[model samples]
Target: MHDSHNSTAARLFETEGTGNPLDVLKRVYGYSAFRGKQQDVVEHVVAGGDAVVLFPTGAGKSLCFQVPALCRNGVGIVVSPLIALMRDQVEALKQLGVRAAALNSSLTRDEAIAVRHSLAAGALDLLYVTPERAVTDAFADMVADTDIALFAIDEAHCVSQWGHDFRPEYRGLGCLASRFPGVPRIALTATADPHTRDDIIKRLGLDRARVFTTSFDRPNIAYEIVERDQPRQQLLRFLSRFKDASGIVYCLSRAKVDDTAEWLNTQGIRALPYHAGMDRALRDAHQDAFLKEERLCLVATVAFGMGIDKPDVRYVAHLDLPGSVEAYYQETGRAGRDGLPSEVWMAYGMADVIQRRRMIDEGGSPEEIKRIERGKLNTLLAICETAGCRRQAILAHFGEAHPGRCGHCDTCLKPVETWDGTEAAIKALAAVYRTGERFGAGHVIDVLMGTINEKTERFGHVDMPVFGAGKDLPPRTWQSVFRQLLAAGLIKVDHSAFGALQLEPEARSVFRRERQVLFRKDRPSSGKAARGTKSATARERSDLAGSDLELFEKLRSQRLAIARDMDVPPYVVFPDTTLIALAKQRPRGFEDLLDVPGIGESKREKYGEAFLAVIDAFEEGGG
Candidate 1:
């Protein structure tokens, strides 16, 4: 199969206009045209110009470099940060019949030698390496001796200190500009705010590169955030909709990841835990299983998803709040990378806010960095508390303007209720002040509700003027008020005093009755609402019905079988989008199969007959 695919690739390059990107796009990758700025970026790089691409997760960022590499001379050098990411991309590229290889610590000695030999012989089209390896003197000398193409930097945001996933090794990549002066370089990432973007450009020395910024909106992903009430039950309710699909559940701690995975298993959901604290071998094994299995959930920390190439992830749920908007965007963007409709759900509460703020305040970052991080955290909180379009708030954080009411997020689907929260805000702030500003929300709420708890009694006689000040409202309503106040910057958490609630400078206006506060009325937790109203598979195959849906399942089974035989992920055989096309079109032969969106010449020549047999069997009543 490998040889046949490689021969097909060779034949493609042997044809007329071999170096033309459009021709390559059609014949090699099986896409008829470029989407958005892909064509322009490809053309610029093919013509020996540097570029920086800021396309979203599923927006064909890989093709912007892969197509240009195929069109230009010599081998393209790709600098990747993760071994798993490099391995996945290399396998995917090879499945397309492109000769690709990666040099990382995971390789055996002989395998490393073979890759080096392949590079020296100019037999590889693209070579992926880590920044640590790429900056070494030995690797630099080896590249100096070889015919070089443009340098493609993946996850270029890692070079920026302001980026959420910064890596110190990426700082060494700045030398690439001086060492390889004439080579065109393209730095690509799916997540970067204005600060991170400028830092990437400056640090990677891409000051002169063409910067292409695409819209950050992932309309296919429906965003939903709920107030944390029985969070495990909330997650389970959300998971019930995607029982037979692959997804990720992110937690804030290693213990939570383990407990969640174990509990999910007891609930009959196939789940595995992943965190940096896990054994390296076990972590790798869990990650490998996640990439290969179809109906599994990986309960993990932020460590598991930096460059995951899996395209069929149906959902990403967060049991706790992320640190910032950028972190939230990047993690949730992992879902529905194939551009099919997906969902991102998060459950958070007042405790999550206090914990996150505590983490930030207790960290050793410089004061300036901590201030910026706090501001970022506040922006994310605002998004969660907003009653308007969640998508609009998310995009606005990235400096992209989306017309409000995206119609897909939870807010647009079911608008939230708001109430005049000014009086409630003042009472909440006064409770904190009357408690000496040294107590957390729970203690303050106790004092407000006139609950004679032991600690409150010890702190005071329970005779303060603000005691029983908020007895009219329920505790849950007061929780919402405090959470929103913290989010709105009207109140702050004092980590040094152990998560104590304190009034911010802005609270003075609210106390003076000069500022009116509004808050989203907290909705009661409903399991049915948590499990969305829309059918789980509706967006991916809304057009397929009856036999077409059956045929899609059959096609997926066949792809999985072939992938298992070749020891590759199922998507590497063919993505679900392609399988849906095949199931709908029921292409009869190689010519018709080539017309499918994802079938290149190599795939057509290699796996075309197997898929065609499936369709034929379905038509003959053997499916």
Candidate 2:
């Protein structure tokens, strides 16, 4: 072991002529193809260029940097945020015979010392550390003095101010490039919108860097949001269809996570609660159990599972709507990573909207808060009540264009019937005006139904002309009417006091019947069909032939086992998409493997042995 005080001057030498970077692919990670823009990304980094890579979850973003790190001279430094994920990745990399180590809080003093020695002695190919630790003076000097090949920022979105997991320490990473001008930098994130993209580029000081963006659409995962009426019961019904399937249920609070997990367990589902409030050992145990075990549902807050590489997850259910659309998109993208059919089910209510708005308002400049609140409400409303394909709506909000219906979401699968809610909306408007628009939905509903409640009688709303005009409509129907009215811009909800309904100027025109307001009549109410149905979009894409299916599943099982032995999640070993490509291509040899997508050298060498063994076994056994 080299002394910690030893200078790393000689470690700065690049691994020149490390063979065709592609040869490294077959030797290290047994991959045959490069997924998406991974090839260009790997080439750019191998040439010592700066880059920003935006690929979706399970898109093999890691290989873009990991492969080049091996081809470039000296050691690669991967700055990741998740401590657990970093440890798992480093351990897996080491197993591939690549000298890899991680520096984090989990490491003992001896372990940290060993890692430093490995760096000084030029014994490491890759070193993973959190941004907090990486930017420290000690770590930064060590990296600056080494022959650094690539500086990879995993979960790069956290470096941006607009991202959900913004960390102030990440801003200091600009110094990495400044301190080591010759070394290449690569920032990779699973999710980032245009604004957040700008923030990342600016914060990382990568203004001149090449940018590679993969498509954000995960066509295999159908997104849907159902209004929260009888939420827990709705959740139970949703879970029934995917019994024994790997899933995640996200709640806003730890107490709620515990309660929901317990409730699900009572219903005979294998469920567990995970949150920051739990003991450290319990959290680690639960995380390990969820990864290693099957049919286990982890009910958690946003705190859990941020850089988790679980690929075979079939579903992600949101018990309450998240704070922003970006959040929703990223969470749901977790499913169907294997390019298999998956569902993104969520339940939303008025309270969820209000709570989200309150969260956005809690801290920030007035302008920033206002901007965030409006964005949140728009996203929430668009998801909850939009009649068109939910996928298109979400994509449109992100400034992406979709030509037609996705035909995969609940709305597209069972199209909603529209009725000219003009009359009903007019009545809803009159009730709000007659009751002074100060009440919430329940109070407004009461007046519309002509219920002689004490509050209604106190305000003389029961005797108003519009009081009983809507009494014939069902409670749910009226609720839909109000929601549509809000959607149509005829009513506004005050954010200050639990979203009390306020009549907008346009409500007068809608009420006068001067302009016809169209709302869906006979809105689709929650039921067995609504809660449980495979997305038509997914079914259409599940077109792989019988042989392909067999190979894919077999490869997946093999990958999962290897991941378990390596202690990383299955997806990190090989994403489902990669497996699908592998099954389709059936590469005959190492050279043929390079032509397959997402198969870079490091990955090929690290994972190649086990995967090739399985494939060879399958082929010989009449696979």
Candidate 3:
């Protein structure tokens, strides 16, 4: 089961475990096969090899560690970031009859002592601890004494200063290797760009570790980016689609979080706000309520929603642009952890971009601010104007090439048609310049459309040559063009010059007729387009005609009974993915069943007899 030199070492462990891991996989986890490289990754860890795993959300990344922790010799030490995550992982393992305990500051003195006693007595299969707790002398002593089989670092990206959610203590985790030289270490993170990935490896001192990256693409999430005009109304429309489904709305400010939560409540959605500014009790209570209660949506700032374990989050809506693609990916990845369909909708505009840059400028040196701003602006613009598959764009930003359209993002469903905006770009730039570049977008927009408002007339801005030149295009189209231009560095905001606009170095190309500008135009809405934009599967379930769905319910009830008799969650017995696969495949026998995903030899042996019988009966009865 163990191989040291092969680059494909992860594969050998899967085939040669204590017994076929497949048998335990079906009976325990109630799945036919591990998702993605989970089986191989688990095998490597069990074989006492070091690895770094990068799997997207809903990719079953946890199983890669948990399964091996159960299969391997001795105890597995899991270093996690959040108390809630540790607690939840422990509880889930305990439910599955796996011996697991969490050591954290959340526990009482006696409770912590009991956990330590259990660890010393060899009573636990896995011990979950935060990075800070694991750095203690006592923990190090235990690791030095015990034959710890594997040391798993969850959320390992936190080790990187370049990562979005940086923790200084995470950098100290390399000491685990020094204390226990023989124990294999596996570091796992859901989000990391190339730079961040390198930093994580360097900080964790895992230079020799084999890297296994399951594609960082979530095809089930429909990504949409819109301008932040009427953001409140846009949010209402977004929540309207969910109705009472579970979700989160991320805001940049505590005040915005509070205001959005209150407004959502007024709109009759069960919602709560969480931020660092809130009272600790209120924040904890709100988090608890959101976790334990179904259909509760949380509106929060960047301070919230890390290490959230909820599997059924139907959507994640962002009211503002995140600081980096890494931040955006992690936040949006919080949705659809069950591999169920989910939505990742965001609204951004010039103000969001400017505010983020301004915040960066205030906090860092001028050079640092410029670096951060460039990265952030590029990320925001990527989200707003990418003509390729949204998933492709995200993965590409992380230095992974996606072959083509994801077939799931908004762009793939309703492709955007772009046109040459060079004339309009020139006109908009000329307008900003002709108006002395003293005003923001609103005033500039009014002048472009030649609005007869008092603000337009106040500046005598309606009479400029550039005025009304862009009237050939919609204001929204022009806005998209200018935003793209800013992102492309053809234009720069001169906050030092009364919020003036200046041509960037690239802008000279446009002025010299050496460059062309192009922009995406809005497409006409259609049924397919509307359905593809959000949770179309959810809509289908709701829109299904009576007879067809009534039959679905009957089949589901029978499946639930069979799952209960076998003592497993119904979804585990037959995941929605598997059931949907079955409904489409209409498997008539064992051969047909084996071809479906999540169906392995163990599943075929144990429940296969009965399930095949049922399918045969259904087919005989014309089902």
- The numbered model that scores best in lDDT is 1
- Model 1 residue 198 distance off true place after TM-score fit, in angstroms: 1.1
Q: Mind giving the per-residue lDDT tens digits that candidate 1 earns over 1-623?
A: 11223323354554321499998898788889999999999999998999999988999999999988888888899999999999999999888888899999999999999999999987888999999998898998988877677899999989987877879999999999898889899999998999899999999889999999899889889999999888889888888878678999999999999999999999999999999999999999999999987998999999999889999999999999999998999999999999998999999999888888888889888898889889999999999999999999999988899998888888888899999989889889988887778988888888888899788778773989888988999998989888899889998999998888888999999999999999998877665563355545665788888999999999999999998998888999999999999998888766887789999988887788899888998989955
Any runs in candidate 3 off by more than 4 Å, and if so which? 1-20, 365-373, 431-439, 442-477, 494-500, 522-529, 532-623
Q: Per-residue CA lDDT of candidate 2, range 59-128, in tens?
A: 8788888889888778889998888888668766754557788888888999999989989887888899
Name the lDDT value of residue 615 in candidate 3: 53
- Arrange candidates by TM-score, highest first: which order? 1, 2, 3
- Model 3 whole-model lDDT (C-alpha atoms): 0.74
**Candidate models: Cα lDDT each:** 0.89, 0.76, 0.74
Task: Mark the regions of model 2 whose C-alpha exceeds 4 Å error after superposition.
Answer: 1-19, 362-367, 487-490, 504-516, 521-526, 530-623
